[model samples]
Target chain A: MARTQGSHSEITGPRVREAAMRLFARHGFAAVSMRQIATEVGVQAGALYNYTPDKQSLLFDLMREHMDALLDAWQQEDPGGTDARARLEAFTRFHIRFNTRRADAVFVSYMELRNLTGENFAAVTELRRIYETRLEEILRAGQDAGVFTLAEPRITAMAVIALLTGVNTWYRDAGRLKLDEVETLYWDMVRRLVGG
Target chain B: MARTQGSHSEITGPRVREAAMRLFARHGFAAVSMRQIATEVGVQAGALYNYTPDKQSLLFDLMREHMDALLDAWQQEDPGGTDARARLEAFTRFHIRFNTRRADAVFVSYMELRNLTGENFAAVTELRRIYETRLEEILRAGQDAGVFTLAEPRITAMAVIALLTGVNTWYRDAGRLKLDEVETLYWDMVRRLVGG
Candidate 1:
C-alpha cells in the first residue's frame, strides 16, 4: 500500500509542486499552510498528503529540484572551447534564462531558504554553495588566464550571483526589456566588472 | 484612561515593531501570532492591542518606516557638484550603510511587503517606487551627459538596485571584508556597469 501510494503521488507530483511553489512564493513558506496549498491545487488537504509528507517537505522538494536542474543545465554546456569572455557570456546567458523562467521558484529558493532546517537546510545550503563555488572557479580560471582583473574573484563571483539572481525578483515576460536585451546589459556589466 | 493608555502604547510602539519585525522575518508573518510577539516583547497578548490594531498594521508600519528612512537618507545626501559616477558612488555607500545596519528591516521591507493591505500596501509601494524612479533619473542623466553607455537607463537602474539590495541577504559583520571594503567593491561594479 505504501509503495502504491508513493508511486501514485509521484504521478501527481509536478502539479502539486507548481501549486505549492506559487503559494509559497506569494505568501512565503512560513505564512502558507498545507490546507491553503491543497485548496490552491484543487485538492482536499488530506488528499494533498498523498503527494508530499508535509508542507515543508513539499517546499524542500521544489527547491531541491530547482538546484539540481540548474546544476545540470550549467554542467551540460560545452564551455570547454570557449575562451574566458565567451564562457562568461555563456554563464550570463544561462543565468538569465534559468532565473527568468523560474521567478517563483527562484524567489522561494533565495528567500525561503531559512525555512529549511537541520539536514534539509544543510543539503539546500550545500547545493547553493556548490553553485556559487562553480562561479568562483570560473572567475579564478579567468584570472589565471590574465583575462579578468578582479581583485577578489570569490567576492566578485558572489556579487555577480547576487546581481544575476536579482533578475528573478523583478523580471517579467511583459516587462520593458526582452530577455536578450537584459542579458546583453548584464553581459556589459560583467565584462566591465573584471575589465574583460 | 484610554488617552493615558494610548500614550503608554506610543512609548512601546517601536519596541512592538522591533518584536514584530524580528518574528515576522524569522518565522514569517503568517507563522507568528500576536501571543508570540507579546511573549517576545514581555507584554500580555492583550496589551499588544494597545499598540498594533492588528498584525498587518505592525508589518505595514515597519515596511513604511524602512522605505521612508531609505528615501530620507538618499535625499539627505548632497549630490551637488557630483557627476553621475560620484552620485553612484554615494548611492552605493548609502545602500550598504543602511542595509547592513538594518538588515532585518530591509528584509522585512522586501519580503513581507505583500502582507500589507489596502492603503498601507499602496503607500509602502509608492515610497519604494519613488526611490527607484529617482535612481533611474540619475542614470538617465548619466546617459545623456555621455558618461554612461547603457542601452536602457531604467533597466540598468533596476539591476543596480537589485545588486545593492541583495547585499543585505548575505552580509554579516564578521565577514572577511569590512563594510567599507564591501561598499567600495559594489561601487566599483556599479561604476563599471555604466561604463565608468
Candidate 2:
C-alpha cells in the first residue's frame, strides 16, 4: 500500500504542477485559483491540497523549479575551461536554447515574479542572482585575460541574459530563423558586445 | 453645463486610467474587475463606462498610449544628424531614460499583452515594430557607412532594445549608479555592440 501510494503521489505531483503552470501562464497567477488548477488536473478542489498547500505555493513551486532547473542545466552544460570566451559562447547558446524550449515556464517565471510572496520572491531572486553571477564570473575572467573589455561585469551579465531571453518574445518554430541560426546570431552579437 | 461636463470627464478620464494602470500593474489584468477599478477611481462601476467601454478597452488604451507616448518621445528626442553613431548614442540614452520613468506602464505593457484581444495585439505590435524599425534604421545606416558590424540589422535592433529596456528590471532611484552613470555605461556597451 505504501509503495502504491508513493507511486500515485509521484505521478500526481508533476501533473498538478504542470496544470498549474499552464493555467498560470495562460491567465496571470493572481487570476488562477486552486479550484481551477484542480479542475485542470481532473481532480476535486480538495485534492489539490495533497499536492500544494495553496495557489501561492503552486506558483512559487513552479518558479522555484524553473530557476533550480535552469541552474542545474547550466551546471551540466557549462564547459569549464581556462578560456572564458569559449565558456561565454557556450552560455549564450545554452541560455537561448534552454529558455526557448521552456517558453511557458520562462513566461511564467518573469510575469509572475511580482505575484510571489515576500519570502518566495527573495528565494527566487537569490537563485536568479546566482545564475547571473555565473555569467558575471565568465565576463570577469575574460576581462582578466584581456580578451574582453567591460565597465561593469554584473550589469553586462544582466544585459546579456536579458538580450538572450528576449528571443522568446518573437521566436517560433515556423519563423524565418531556426534555433541554431538564432543562437549563432546572438552569440556573435554577445561576442561583439564583450569585445571578445 | 457643457463646459462642466467636459472638464469633469477630462479630469476623471486620466484618473481612471491611472487607477487602472496601478491596479493592473499590482495585480494582473485578468484578476482586476471593473468594480474594483471603479472603487479605486472613486467612481461607481457604471460610471467607468463613460470613460472606457470595458476593462479590455482600458487595457488597450493604456498600452496604446504607452506606445504612442514612447514613439512621440523618441521622435522629440532623436538628435537627427547624418552621423549614425551619434544617433545610436541618442537612442541608447533616450530609451533607458524614457522607460525608467514610466516603469509601471512598461511593466503592464509587457505583462498584459497576452491578455489583449487579437485585434488589439496586432495594433500594439505594429506600433512596437515601428519603434523597433526606428532602431533598425539607425543600425542599417551605420552598416551602410561601414561603421557598425552587423550580420542582421533587424535582429540586432531587437537585441539592443532588449538590452537597453532591461534597465527597468533592476534600476532604483537609490541604487549605486545615478541615471547619468547608468546611461553612460549602457551607451558604451551599445557602441561596442554595433562596433561603432
Candidate 3:
C-alpha cells in the first residue's frame, strides 16, 4: 500500500504551525528564520519546508487560519434570530473569550500584517474586514431597529472592537475579576457607549 | 579648541534617535542592528556609540523619552481648575491629538515593549501606569462628584485609552473626517461610556 499525503502531513503540519506562531509572536516574523522555526518544532529545515513552502506562507497560513477560526467561532456563537442588543452582547462576550484564549494568534494577526506580501496582506485585511463587517452589520441592525443609538456604525464597530480586544493586555486567569465578571463590566461600557 | 560633548551630541543625538525609531518601527526591534541604525544616521558604527551606549540603551532611551514626552505633554494639557467632565474632555482630545501626531513613536512604544530589558520594561510600564492613573483619577473624581457613573474606573480608563489609541491604526490625514471631527465623535462615545 502506498503512503497517503494526509499521513505524512497530518502529523507535522500542526507542529510546524505551532512553532511558527510561537517564534513569530516572540521574535517577530522578519526576525525569525525558517531554520529557527524548524528547530523549535524539533524537525529538520527540509522537513519543515515539506509542511510550509516558506516563512511568508507560514505567516499567511497562521493569520488566515486565525481569522477563519474567529469567523467560524462567531458564527457558532451568533445566536441567530435574536434582537440587535442580544447579538451585540454575544459579540462582546464572544470576542473577549475567543481572543483571550488565543493570545499568540491575536498578537501575530495584529503585529505582522506589515510583513505579509501585498496579496497576502490584502487577503488577510479582507478577512479582517469581513469580521469587522459582521460587527458593523449588527450595529447597523441595532441603529435601524432603534435599539442602539450610535450615529456611525462603522466607527462604532471599530471602537467597540478595540475596546474588547484591549482586554487581552491585562486579563489574567488568577487576577481579581473572573472572566464572566470582566465580561459584564465590559458589556456595560459597550452598551453605554452605543447609548443602549 | 576641543569639541564640547554637548555641541556634537546635540546635533547627532536627535538624528540617532530618529534613525533608531524609524528602523524599529519599520522592522522589529530585535531584527534591527546598531550597524543599520548607524548607517541610517550616516555615522560610522563606532561613532554611533558616542551617541548611545548600545542598541538596548537606544531602545530604552527611545521608549523612556516617548513616555516622558507624553507625560510632560499631558501635564501641559491638563485643565487644573476644571470640573471632572471638563478635564475628562480635555484628556480625550489631548490623547488623540498627541498620539496621532507621533504615530511612529506610538507604534514602536506598543510593539517593542516585549523586547525591553526587565528593568527597562518596568520603568516603561511604570510610566504607562502613571498615565493610566491620571485617567483613572479623572474617572474617580467624576464618580465621586456624581458627574460620571462608571463602575470600574480602572477598567474604563484602560478601555478608553485602547479605543483612542486605536485611531492610530486606521486614521489617515486625507481621510474624510478631520482631526477635530474625529475627536468630537470619540468624545461623544466616551462621554456616553462614562454615563455622563
DockQ of each: 0.66, 0.78, 0.79
**Alpha-carbon TM-score of each model against the true structure:** 0.90, 0.95, 0.95
Please identify model 2 stretches exceeding 4 Å from their true place.
Answer: A1-11, B1-11
Docking class of predicted structure 3: medium
lDDT of each residue in B1-196, candidate 2, tens digit only:
1234444454367899999999999999999999999888766676678878889999999999999999999999898877999999999999999999999999999888999999999999999999999999999999999988888898899999989989999899999999999999999888988887
In terms of lDDT, the poorest run of 10 residues in model 2 chain A is: A1-10
Q: Number of clashing residue pairs in every model?
A: 0, 0, 0
| Collision pairs in model 1 | none
Shift of residue A15 alpha carbon in model 1, Å: 2.1
lDDT, model 2, position B143: 94
By lDDT, the better pick of 1 and 3 is 3
Give me the runs in candidate 1 sitting further than 4 Å from their true place: A1-11, A42-47, B1-11
> What tens digits encode model 1's per-residue C-alpha lDDT throughout B54-116?
888788888888888889888998384549778878888988888889977877777776677
**What class would a CAPRI assessor give candidate 2's docking?**
medium
What number of backbone clashes does candidate 1 have, counting pairs of residues 3 or more apart or in separate chains?
0
Candidate 2: tens digits of C-alpha lDDT, residues A1-196:
1134344354377898888888888898888888888778776676668777888888888899999999999999999988999999999999999999999899999888998899999999999999999999999999999999888999999999999999988889999999999999999889989988
The DockQ value obtained for model 1 is 0.66
Between candidates 1 and 2, the lDDT winner:
2
- lDDT per residue for candidate 3 within B26-67, as digits (tens), equals 888989999999778765676777778899999999999999
